[model samples]
Target: MSRTTPATLALDRAGVAYELATYDYDPKAERVGLQAADALGAPPGEVLKTLMVKVDGRPACVVLASDREVSMKKLAAALGGKSAEMMKPADAERLTGYRVGGVSPFGQKRAVPTIVDAPAAALPQAYVNGGQRGLQVRLAPADLVRLAGAQVAPVT
Candidate 1:
């Protein structure tokens, strides 16, 4: 467990409680979220990945299950945009203040609109990147929603 990261601090400011989980990180892993789920010994569906996307050229955050893919059409519609695409890794990092493999929905450099796929709320608790690679935070779905100021939609 490490000290407070911006993500954790955001949770603190929101009066949200969470537990931290850390594991050995392998840069070679193709899917960061899958790797984290495996390390945390949780089902892939219980772990969410924070994705940076451009909806009509505006940056936004989308979170979904580790095992699922975000549907661009659905995400765009959710954001009232015509189209959406994944953000470039460099741009995503710069905008979110986190590395490619460790983007979190909270504590961003700027307040970006966030959408959390509805499926994530099905789980009792969810694991998400803790603003750093190899670190994760577990919290109730309601807390996550509140902390991220996220809208829930069927975007996965």
Candidate 2:
């Protein structure tokens, strides 16, 4: 078994029950989330891709379905910012303390504002990166809200 990442540790500290899943990772895969969904045999909608964005130059995370695209305008509006842009990969890695393909919403190096798209919250459970590639954590949507202190909004 792989070592628990800060994300899993945070869940533990919060007393949240979660399931850890690991699979063979193809580093060359184009879309990280789709690869994980295929490897885990889970529906794309059940797996969310955590994206880091800069809203008004402040770093924040947006969690949306693996197959969906985040609307920058909607995101900016939801966060009450004037503009939204995807964070540079290098900046994202540096800020989150995780690689580009494995940035999870939990246990970031610093706690940045996070917005969970409404569609994701509608699901009973969702899979998110567990702070490393090929690792995923499945937990109730409510747990994500409580653990990450994420704002539930329609940012997708």
Tell me which residue pairs clash in candidate 1. none
Please identify model 1 stretches exceeding 4 Å from their true place. Answer: none
Could you tell me which 10 consecutive residues in candidate 2 have the lowest summed lDDT?
A: 1-10
Against the unseen true structure, what C-alpha lDDT does each candidate score?
0.90, 0.90
State how far residue 35 of model 2 sits from its true place (Å): 1.0
Model 2 residue 93 distance off true place after TM-score fit, in angstroms: 0.8
Candidate 2, 1-156: lDDT as tens digits: 465888888988999999999887788988888988999999999999999999999999999999889999999998899999999999999999998888999999999989998989889998988998888999988788878999999887
Which lDDT tens digits does candidate 1 get at residues 2-48?
64789999988888888988988778999988988898889999999
TM-score of 2: 0.97
